[model samples]
Target: MFRISQYLRELAQAQATGSYPTPRERHAKGPVVIWNLIRRCNLTCKHCYALSADHDYAGELSLPEVFTVMDDLKAFGVPALILSGGEPLLRPDLFEIAARARDLGFYTGLSTNGTLIDAPMAARIAGAGFDYVGISLDGLKPTHDKFRRLDGAFDRSLAAIRHLATHNVKVGLRFTMTALNAHDLPALLQLMQDEGANKFYFSHLNYAGRGNIHRDKDAHHQATRTAMDLLFDHAWAAAQAGSLDDYVSGNNDADGPYLLQWVRQHLPQWEEALRQRLVAWGGNASGQMVANIDNLGHVHPDTMWWHHDLGSVRARPFSQIWNDTSDPLMAGLKQRPRPVQGRCASCQYLSICNGNTRVRAQQLTGNPWFEDPGCYLSDAEVGAVSTPFETPANKHARRTIEIAHV
Candidate 1:
């Protein structure tokens, strides 16, 4: 994930001579764990990566088991933990687990649908001292409700955000972009400003679980570029106006390169500095900086890889599973200059975006090394030149020279 707002601000304020500061390097000890405490959700979202339903899954970890995992994470020096779910608040011990995580010195965050966060619940969450709360709001009333597969969901979620704000809880909005909701982005940004949201997380749709069914509906290249332009403009303007503090994009590392290009064209002076900062940030951290532990304690490189299990916490500890490089996928993911195929292999900005999202490539092409189908950059943009540089006579001379050597 790239925090474009913060990076842009840093670049705008930085001195010309010195390099900007880098974010804390991840995966030195353990990946930030996105623990799915439960798999049951009230609403069936159109692009739900989990395909979570209203019914209970059979093998969710118990409270004691969750405590055990939390203890292990703390011991392993995991920097942060995000409690996610079909709807995490639906868990009976949600607050208790959150409190326990805090007690153990974890930077705990909550990811929820927001419809379940009422006034009293908001008060409880605030009192629990969660580091942050991210609530999903896809778009305005009609669009959001349709995406959520329920009417009145938009009003209820908006009410929840207001309630959380009233309680002084640090809350952010999570919006997943697709053809259905891309048009609503401007209105949604205005809503964020009006609602006084602390942050906005923009996610590009990834093909997984229920999302795979809607792959055709993913935003086209132009739409994606337009959406990103809107987000950058709003976020940059908000920073200048001293409104929102954070704006991030996820599920696609191509965003980093895209932002670099934007800076090159618009704010030419900051281009070099921003490029250095992005290279240090190192995009696409799955299987390295990020990991997912599903409701059943199965470990994956990321949330979208629910179908591809690396290991099981029930059988072995998370630290053990994450550190075991014998697994081919895990090993390849941690390698520098990853063995990626097609355009991603030859991208000029490979240092910034480490092969984009491997899961997307795997999902679309049935080979994880293939170019990510979700990458919105063009061949020219990514530095893919089909024709060879040498002429036919030069090529024949080179072939003759190689034959002499053979």
Candidate 2:
């Protein structure tokens, strides 16, 4: 994930000459862990990648087992642990686990649906010393309620956000973009500003679990560009106003190139600096810098790869699973220059995006090496004539045309 608001502030306001700071770079010693403590949720959201339900899942790691895994992760030098779930607050020992992770010196965060966080819950979360809490709210009342598959969910979620804010829990808003709710983005941004949210995370819809069923509803190319423009504008304004400076986009490393293009056109003077910073950030660090331990203790490269298990914490320690290069998928992901195929293999920004999201490619084409179908950039924008599916192009002519347009 990239914080566009911070980048814009550092570029235009601070005029900093050095590289932009990144969580990945700052915590170079260990990978960020997404630990799904539970798999039960009250609401069946349309874009739920976990495919979670209201019922309890069998084989969840026991409390002692979870503690053992947490200890191992801490010993392995994991810097941050994000407690996620169908709804993490639903767990009986949620706060206890969070407190334990904090005590173990891990920067703990919570990912939730927000409906379950009442006043008491908010206080407990704040007391647990959670570094951050990200609550998902798709849109305004009607839209959000529909997406969440429940009426009054919007109000409940908003109440939770307000309650968290009152307790000074450092809460943020998480909105997953799709064709059904993209139009509500402006209103959601205003809501964030009005609610005094500390951050805003705009997640592009990824095809996994229930999300795969809605892939057809993912934002189109032009719509995605327009939405990004709105986000950049809003984030830039927020930065200038000295409020809500953390604006992030996730599940799409194409966003990096998109932002670079935006800076080139709007903030031309800082383009080179932003480019250098982005390159250093080294996009899509799924297998290398991020890992997921599901509720059942299966280890994946990232949270979205529940279908692709690299190893199991129940079988081997997370350190051993992460360090082992025996798994073909894990080994390929660790390779600096991955052996990607199609447009990804030819992309000039390979160093910047690291082949984008492999999971998306694998889902769409049934091959991880194939280019990500979610990449919305045009051939001209990516400095390519065509992809494998498109007609072969005259490279010189295409380059001349693109240069002239620029």
Candidate 3:
């Protein structure tokens, strides 16, 4: 059985002792809570959901407010808080706030537009004792500016990233991939190569932002579909060729192994061929792909569509905010725990909790995130990875699909 009990137990003990747990300790041991200090940003990206005019959030988290959240989270035992915003630096008291959080024993971090990250500012942050930072770099320069709308945003951001790197600050690149940047995958990869960014998360743009929210769905989706095809084609091709193996080789042991094994199984003979393709793929796809906080305190998780209470974040006594009882989008949350059977019940990852965003999934597929798309066996020792196909059925149904042609 897939029991995460051990994982949970280890996490609890680590937090209790103020020492990070094993697997999590190796990387980031925290549950990663986002503090939306504000929502107003100088550059308007159209893909923002909480950007609507109606979304009114207090400009900043007051010291008392910040203290409340920190104390609560500390009590509840969340290990970290990632402070983001329309721009976190926009709030003048950022360092003080961060210092307070750090003093409270919560691992404090920041996400920024990089426009404000200077040597002095960086020093303040380092002195304030933030653990890490995430920098947004959609492309080298041209593409990034087009999306962020600041003329020199890309160069400045890149400069900030390099500056942080020089200061020995750990940084990760944030790439929100979109239909526009979708075809430019290779370009993005090259930029990352130049930047020495170790972590890359690809996200799809969502419908909420300043962009064409009410635009033609078919056309937009089609363009996205086309872009995805091109992007995945390169990815698949890279896997087919030897290009992926090279990237995997470049990836440190832990970093590249999963991607390598995943490609080996999915692309098979062309695994090396897949690696050969040159990629400048756009950075992480954008929008609702991952939940974020706005300048205000709206803590939104990408998978769920609801405004989570910031106080409840990392705060146990505050109670869980997104539980079905409190979330507006999840009317069915407490309805009943649907009994699983057949494929879902017996599947390896049966304790699957990841579901689609309530609003988007309901509107798009009328079905929530019922499938775990990223559940491939990335570790070679896990055994063969399989895709749905016509073959001898493992379990019978009137009509059946089997794991075939792995």
Candidate 4:
């Protein structure tokens, strides 16, 4: 049953990403969604969008709320769900939640920091009937420890990975880039190579959480153009080399939009459908996912909301900043600290890029998404942009190595 859920999810993702319209005119509303089970975390990392576990989470959503959310999600026809938290395993009710989601027939899964993933816990997670397990692994031990701020975390995570690997489970990796270790892209990428990771995602350090704090700012030290380009080039090469074929995905404005756009154009026929799927189901689609729970409680069509969340990169919020959609949050970020030179406006990639993250701009120049004239990335956006580029981000792709910050 778990295997079937994963297969279906992947097939749906591949189909949706291929630019081909669904065979069934009435498609599944969502393939997956993230449940921020609780905003509590065990680690205090350098660049966390959720910041530290400092937020008041004493009043976490009751099991009833989870059920309500699941019911709503069922209504929207969402199929999969990822239970997350500061560390989802930290929640004493984890087993119950996982079992319930699975009972509902949803492709249930959990994303964790792995600190609390003991042998019993791992067994329970598997027994709970989740389809896949996503573990945060920024890099190798040294690099990972530096970024995550937990010395033995890397080992614990490896244990969890090995445990999962030993099971009939689908495993994935998460990489969050930060300024502190921006220079070790190659080494970080190496970990991905070594692990034979099924699906790997690299994320830009978001300007939220502890990330909102000054230490989280990597805009100045972080690799923008050079790193992104390198990582893209490397990943594409790796893909062709047969090392990775699961298909990498993420929501970094710095790379995702440009890369996705480039990929779509080259693979034209499927671009529209893929983009629409991404735009509608990406990170910002949480609201829609919340409406899809069925009565008997079998979940289907889980939505990976990242692709859908960043609908626009220049819009404002209707309510408070925190409550706004990822699209508008990203969009509104671009307008801050207006570009110094008129070059970006005239640049071809201007329309595609999110002007960099709001905090990156502010961290480097006190303005969100404002191009730092001194940075190579800011200049390259307008310079190398062509009608089409063979690769998404060669520099970025190369700079990345296996480390675990995200």
Candidate 5:
């Protein structure tokens, strides 16, 4: 994840320890696990990475099984638990698991589609003591309803946000950007302010599950650049105005170097310092710092790797499964410099992006180590061979930079 708000606001100085100063760049004590508590959802979202349906999925982990995993995670030194699902709220034992997680001293968070979170539900969420609650909103009412494939979804979700804020539950907006919803980002940011949302997460749509089926909707590189520019401007302005809102982007690690380029143009004096920080951030953590557990207790490197199963927690303890590295995929993911091919192999900013998202490469090329097709960076920016997806604007910008150097 790229912490745009932190970078723009300078919320914390990079703690230079040896070469890797940032906590993320340093070796983490344990992975932050994103646990899919259930596979049932009320609304069938167009880009549902879990491809959730209205009905319950068979063979999900039972309450006892969940408790066992929680204990294992706590004992294994897992720092945080992000409880997600088709819609985590649909889980019957959602609060029970959450309360238990808190008792176990885990920093737990809830990821939900806010349509189900009414006033009472919001109150329950606050009582459960979640450190954070992220609600997915694709766009403004009309567009969001279309993407959600349900009428009144937008209104219900908006109400849920207000309800969360009323109960003092720290809530944030989680928007998966696509060609279908990129136009609404500015309005969504406005909604964040109007609703007193504490954070905004701009997720680049990854090619997984339903998202893959609709890959044509992924935003164009030019559109992505435009969106990032808007976000940077808004975040910096908010910081100047003393607003303590947070902004994060995920799925595509290219945002890291993109942010650095933004800094070079807007805050040239701090460019070198930011580069060091990015290096320490260590790009994408995937199998290293980030992990995933599906509803059936299957372990994966990350949430997007739903198709790749490392091991089942029932058969093997999560701690053992995560550390074994016997699985070739897991072994490759754990490698510091992943054996990525094509453009990723030679990108100058490999340390900052870790070859972007490997899942994208795997989805398109049937090779986990291939270059990420979703990367929006130009050949010039990454200092690699010519990129096939380069836009005319990238060429213009490169030419302008060349002229200035001369």
Candidate 6:
């Protein structure tokens, strides 16, 4: 995640103390785990990465099973836990699991579609001592309902936000951008301000599950750039005004470099310092610094790698599976200066993006190391203008290696 507000407001302090995003010290301990507590959701979001439905999925971890995994995660030195699901509130044991996680000292968060967060639910969530609750909102009423496929989902979710805020819970808005909702971003930002939200998360659409089927709906490159510019403008203005509302974006790692370019154009004096800090940030930490545990105890490099399992937490401790690095996919992902091919291999800002999202490449080209189709930066912006172009044979060789590794 790119912490736009943090960088804009606290860059100097972060640089001085080495407490930036993807902090090295914290990463050394363990990855932040996004654990899907269940696979049942009331709403069928069009871009659902889990392809979740309302019915209970077979083999979902029971309360006792989740307790065991929480013990293992805490012992593994996992610093934080983001409890998620098709919609986590549907689980009968949601609060029980969350309460246990809090007792174990995990910086527990709840990622839910806020339609379920009523007054009672809000109180329970606040009582659970959740660090934050991220409620997904695709757009304004009409657009959001269209994407969510429910007529009143927008009202229910908006009410959920208000309910959480009334309880003094830190509530953030999570938006997954697409062509359908790109125009609503400005209004969403306004909504965040009007609702006194603690954070606003802009997620770039990735190709996975239902999202893969809807890839054409992904926002155009120019639209994405415009959105990033809007974010920069808002974040910078907030920083100047002493508003600490957190602004962040996820899925696209190129956002780091894009933000740097924004700084170059707007805050030129801080360009070099921010560049060095981003280099230290070391871009995408999928298989290493981020991880996912699905509803049934399978572990992934990150949430996006649902199709690629490293191992099952039921079979082995998460620490062992994460540190094993025996699996070729794990080894490749954990490797520094990852063996990325094509334009990614030559991009000067590769350090800032780490080849962007590998899953996108894997989805499109059947090779995880190939250049991510989602990277929107131009060759000139990335300083790859004079690099040797990748040939068909080179592409073929990469594919061969990928096949062998898998």
Q: Considering only N, C-alpha and C atoms within 3 Å, which residue pairs clash in candidate 1?
A: none
On residues 106-141, what C-alpha lDDT tens digit does candidate 4 reach at each position? 888787887777777777777888887888877778
- Model 5, residue 167: C-alpha shift (Å): 1.1
lDDT of every predicted structure (CA atoms): 0.87, 0.86, 0.48, 0.52, 0.88, 0.87
Q: What is the RMSD of candidate 3?
A: 12.2
| Better structure of 2 and 5 per TM-score | 2
Query: How do the residues 187-215 of candidate 6 rate in per-residue lDDT, one tens digit apiece?
Result: 99999999999999999999998899999
Candidate 6: C-alpha lDDT: 0.87
Candidate 1 lDDT over 1-406, as tens digits, reads 7788887767555533355555554454767889899999999999999999999899899999999988888888888999999899999999899889889888899999999888999999999999999999999999999999999999999999999999888889999999988988989888887898988999999989888889999989799999999888877776667555789999999999999999888878778878888888888999998999999999999999998898888899998999989988899899998898787778898889998999887876667877777888888998974322344578799999999999
After superposing candidate 1 on the true structure, give the runs of residues whose Cα lies further than 4 Å from its correct spot: 15-28, 385-406
Best by lDDT: 5
Candidate 6 is scored at a TM of 0.92
CA shift at 25, candidate 1, in angstroms? 6.8
Worst 10 residues of 5 by lDDT: 11-20
Error of 4 at 14 (Å): 15
TM-score of each: 0.92, 0.92, 0.60, 0.62, 0.91, 0.92
Question: lDDT per residue, candidate 5, 1-406, as tens digits?
Answer: 7889877766233222222234334434889999998999998999998989999899999999999999998888899999999899989888899999999999899998898888889899999999999998999999999999999999999999999888888999999999988999999999999899999999998989998899998999999999999999888887767678998999999999999999889867678888877887888989988999999999999999999999999999999999987899888888989898888989998989988899988887677887888889998889888434334577689899999999
- Alpha-carbon error at 113 in model 1, in Å? 0.6
User: Candidate 2, residues 209-235: lDDT per residue as tens digits?
Assistant: 888888999989788899889999988
| Residue pairs of candidate 5 with colliding backbone atoms | none
- Judged by whole-model lDDT over C-alpha atoms, candidate 5 comes out at 0.88
